[model samples]
Target: MILLVVGADRVDAGKTTFSTGLLERTGAVGYKPRAGNDFWFDHDDCRRALADGRLYGKDAARLSAAASRGRAPERLNPVHRLWQPSPDGGSGLLGRSDREFVVDRIGRDPEDALFVRNATAEVPDAVADALPLADAVSIETVAEFNDLTEREYVPAFDRLADEIEDTDVAVVESYSDIARPLSSLDPAQVAAVAAVEPGRVRIYSGDRYCRACEIASSSPRDGAIEKRVPDVLDYLDPLERVRLPPLDKEQRDDPARIARAYANAYDAFLDAAGRV
Candidate 1:
């Protein structure tokens, strides 16, 4: 088994897109290690999948369908953290403390509405059991752009790494850059990279010639992105590169084709890895 981590140069750079595409093409077991607390509530798709017996985070649902359907979303995304309103900001059952609010509430446990520490033990065995059964396994961390050093984040990352350590390909989303520097990443990012060590990192970015990409390419990380592109006959670095299509606005923003293009990019990745 090989672990193939799909990460973006920056957020929205298509990490999940590439992961889902690769899962489809490779028949890899998919695990979305870190998902938000309100994931199911926020995504109607996840609510639908869960209603049908498979519970998934937004990203996990897409991956489960594309790579291995029929498995429950809870199995795909076992470690989830809710981002509920802080207790001090609270009043209702979910927040409001009124009887009508209680009745109006979904009637689940009160603790369910709180953002608890990320506990790895929460990860069900079903995920571990399913991994070796596929061609490969792909794990997506929570959004990888924001608070990386938060104490709440590392346990889940450690847990995921331990879970998939033996697999042939381990594809992680955003942990690689955490160890860099504060100035390198966004502080208010909604996602965080897990701290799992990566064997190979493939930096995914859009076409440099694209207008939006050109602007994004102006950031500090963009300079890092530029340096990552090896010049002709340049010394081989450990990092491999995969460029996403220089899509028109429609194609670039289309969620469905995002997966398709990522699938296409994975083919290119395989060629680069010589896995082809």
Candidate 2:
């Protein structure tokens, strides 16, 4: 399966929309390897679950709805980070110094538990065994909070890497820009995108300010292809690229109309990918 890294030069550059379009058009699954942001749920039940700490992410929920086939939403986003404050005054999402919450979640899988146990001897068996049976775990650890450590990140990275390896046409969405000196897209993440075989990883840039373009331009291109995504207003034909009038604000805001735009963009992307 090809690995398509859907990313933008800046935040809210329509990465998710583009990915959603691809999933809708191609039947490809979505995997958010590393997500660090707020969870927003439009459904009242999801909001309540999040308030109660039972559910953690909004992006995962939507991705699950759009893709996941029959798998759980949590599987798509195994490790996540948010800005919730911990009890200790430290800013990690998960409260407490011992981080039993993180340990427990990762340790739920017997093999993953072993990996966690090996990462730090401080983890107790009860915590390891207490892995919630739920499909996903909401991790509140963030680097900004200074709550994340190498031990925790290692397991999360392992999970991320494992998923990418196992997935077919993994649409990896980048977090932030890597070219900006202080970008969210780490060098390691860029390396992961680069690791895909040449011509297998399709890097598409969105809009004029896209950071993904910088990444694509700066990163080594042994065989990987980089193409500009068609503007949302375009009526893209898989056989030919066509331009259409831009959508008015009302039409753009309509979910149904935006979905159609994504479909067109996906056609263009797939067409470009085919030629490569």
Candidate 3:
């Protein structure tokens, strides 16, 4: 069964924190299909991962650690993108004014494939040198990037889904506010869906939630057209709403502590999912 955890806020909705606790309580495996970090803001994390000849955001790392049988961060998160801010009022290949794409790490292998954007020449020398450029696919435009994702990332996600089938429950976390991370995932496969904010979580029926996503997207189910949380929520009523207490830094990091503190909320989620 799949328990999807999605963010209501665009950023910092505590999806990872909530998912960690759920995994601890249920002994479920974790999966973060896609994730990213900014080069300017998440410098330390970027540098550390680069030092190990890889790239992965902290969320994926934490999810891997919280799982019943811990997996490699790359295997847990199949697609990770690196971004940098454009301070000089310039745009990258994707045409975003504030930030530009640097590179993308796709698939799960000892030597994962890298998609280095042509705009990387504009990045700082130290950061560029540290990137895994050897045997990397060079991308020049948004269309090319989209093509690459269709060709490569889709298959990687498929493989990851196949791997998850062996586990009893898989906690699937969506990126940002995206309703569903994997387009291929059937609604019937999901046990429950949770939309989380700062101090509360709203539970919805899995099939209804996926149908809402389809309505919100209003496009073909290619996983390319993503709908935000509010857009999907417009079509359905929640099964339950549970309040969450604030956690101290130590408590937030400890999965067992989080599970204990959030026992009520977890119970509500399981009950809504029909697991109880």
Candidate 4:
């Protein structure tokens, strides 16, 4: 069964916290299909990943640790984008204001590759040099990045999906507020969906959630245009809402503590997923 955890807020939606707790409770393997971090705001994490010759967010690391067998962060997160703030108060290559797309790490382990965007040159020299550029592919335009992702991302996601097929449960954490991270992930395979925020979680039945996604999505099922939380919420009401109390730093880091604290919420998620 696939239990999908998505965010309502664009940032810090507590999806990771909820997911780690779920993984600890269910012994499910965690998969964060896509993730990214800002070079300016998440400098320490970015530098730590660069030191290891790869890039992945702290969320992926946390999920990795919380999983049953503890997969590598790169494996748990197949696609990781590295972003930087544009210094001149302008949009960078991807056309987002005050932000630039530095690089994207796709695939995992021996098959992994990096797509370094032209914006890399504009970042700090230390970051630029530390990035694994030896085998990186340089992208010069938005069209190029699109074309590359169109060819790479889905295939890489599929490869990772194959590895987790044997597990009883796979917990997928979406990136940002994206309704679904990978277009290739079949909603039919999803047993339940959780839309998370700072202090609450809305649980949706998989079939109804899939219907909402289909109705709200303007693009075809295989298209690149990702639907957001509000888009789908317009079509369906959640099955239930579970309150999540704030956690201290120590509790947040301990999956068992988190599971115990949020047992009711986790139980609701499993019941919705038909696990109960």
Candidate 5:
């Protein structure tokens, strides 16, 4: 199984959307891999989190038959950190935390839990323990840096490298928007990361992508789509089924745009299924 780690220049480059897109492409559910109870969910949590509940009702139904594929979402996304929306917002363990929640407790296969993480250098130790070691791995690169400072991110990678220890090769998602002088990131260091895993693929959004997203925040023109998505859209062609940035926040709020993007992502899913 391949562990795909998605990233972007910063927050809105559509990591979640891209992860959703990849799941669609992979016939895998678009799960956060880190749904938690003071911890991320286990495979059973994903399965039990069926159509009966909120957003995942349909998903729970779809995944019901599958055995944790091989790992739990928590195992996939061992550690995470999210800032409270407002400074006063509560912040603690981001997702499900332990094997108990993932094992028979949540009620699914622990092995099949492959996770999708919006990783940074600063993930927690326990969370790192839970993540699956990739036979193959893919990392999405950022085009720009959001608020993360060189101070925080520089040491993060040291921690990240500690996780896998060593592997064959790790695919690096390349980017053009990141400015230099990032103490934490050294583009030159990509080769070293790749040294761990030599089999790699670099997915570019397009020969052309928006250098500047017109929407300050991704919002949709459609009423039902998500405000987090972009208005300009098109379905991904099968051969070009790689995930890209998601629609802006505004797009997530728009119903029509949300449907369109979801449909577009689904198209990629259909195409990918045909191959494997």
Candidate 6:
């Protein structure tokens, strides 16, 4: 499953951690269009791929795809930097185009990948665009711009969930840590997460973690298919091939660590896929 993880502009909301959890839980491919956390696809990967491969488009896509599997250029790290606006002090993420670039090499490469501007809803759209078109995509919806929202993140999340329902999903994040089943979280996210890790501990909502110790026994979407259901399933879940997302031990940022975690698990998924 080529899932897109969307992070709102909050640091500790656990979007990356939740993505890591999803990757770990399902053992999916863990593809990174552009590195946000520790899992980086720096310029070197692009350069190396560009140098070694005849097809720049295919190879560049492959390089981004491979970062999650532990083999990528060194420059991939520091894919993005933290930048906040002056005076207002609002959050702004360093993009691939940032002057003091970290993932500058990507820009040097010919691929169309963009250094994400911020980890907001905008990031997901960019991620969706960069991917080489996958069967399904999973998006992690969280608060944007640190709105100090209680359930206010729901609208953005709901829009996201509505947009991607027909695409793909493995384990989607929900703010229902207490298992309240609030409408803020789409039923599909609840269904997807609940179905995948039935009766296991899952991050329900950004607010708290929910121990999914109780299986619904029936499908969360039991009654009928909702409107425009994406008709896609995470092919990687049943896949035993495990991709072990490489971890950068020196780094402390949860996003980076989660990226590596996803990469490691993705490598595991590849291993599992080999048997097929």
Top candidate on lDDT is 3
Residues 115-222 of candidate 3 have per-residue lDDT tens digits of 555544365565668666656788776688688777888888888877766568889999888888877775787889989999999999898888888888543222
**lDDT of candidate 1 over 26-62, digit per residue (tens):** 5556665544433323545534533543333556555
Q: What's the lDDT for candidate 2?
A: 0.40
Model 5 per-residue lDDT tens digits across residues 72-122: 333223222221122233221222122111111111233332233333223
lDDT of 5 at 79: 22
List, residue by residue over 25-63, the lDDT tens digit for candidate 6.
Answer: 454433222222211234343343435421122222333
Indicate the TM-score of model 4.
Answer: 0.92
Report the lDDT tens digits of candidate 4 across residue range 1-276: 789999999889999999999999998889998888988899999888888766788999999998857468887888888777776765556666677777778877624565555643465665668766656788777677678776887688877777655557899999888887766666678899999999999999987887788779663221257788878888888888999999999999999999999999998889999942
Clashes per model (N, Cα, C within 3 A): 23, 4, 0, 0, 76, 35
* CA shift of 262, model 5, Å: 9.1
Residue 162's lDDT within candidate 2 is 61
In terms of lDDT, model 5 sits at 0.28
Model 6, 131: alpha-carbon shift in Å? Answer: 21
Q: Quick one: ranking by lDDT, best first?
A: 3, 4, 2, 1, 6, 5
All models: lDDT?
Answer: 0.36, 0.40, 0.82, 0.81, 0.28, 0.30
Residues 4-75, model 2: lDDT tens digits: 443324444444444554566667667665454422213453444344434335555556667647655456
Give the distance in Å from residue 195's predicted Cα in candidate 2 to where it truly belongs.
18
The alpha-carbon RMSD values of the candidates against the true structure, listed in the order shown, are: 14.3, 11.3, 2.5, 2.6, 15.5, 15.1
State residue 80's C-alpha deviation in candidate 3, in Å: 0.2
Residue 60 displacement in candidate 2 (angstroms): 1.5
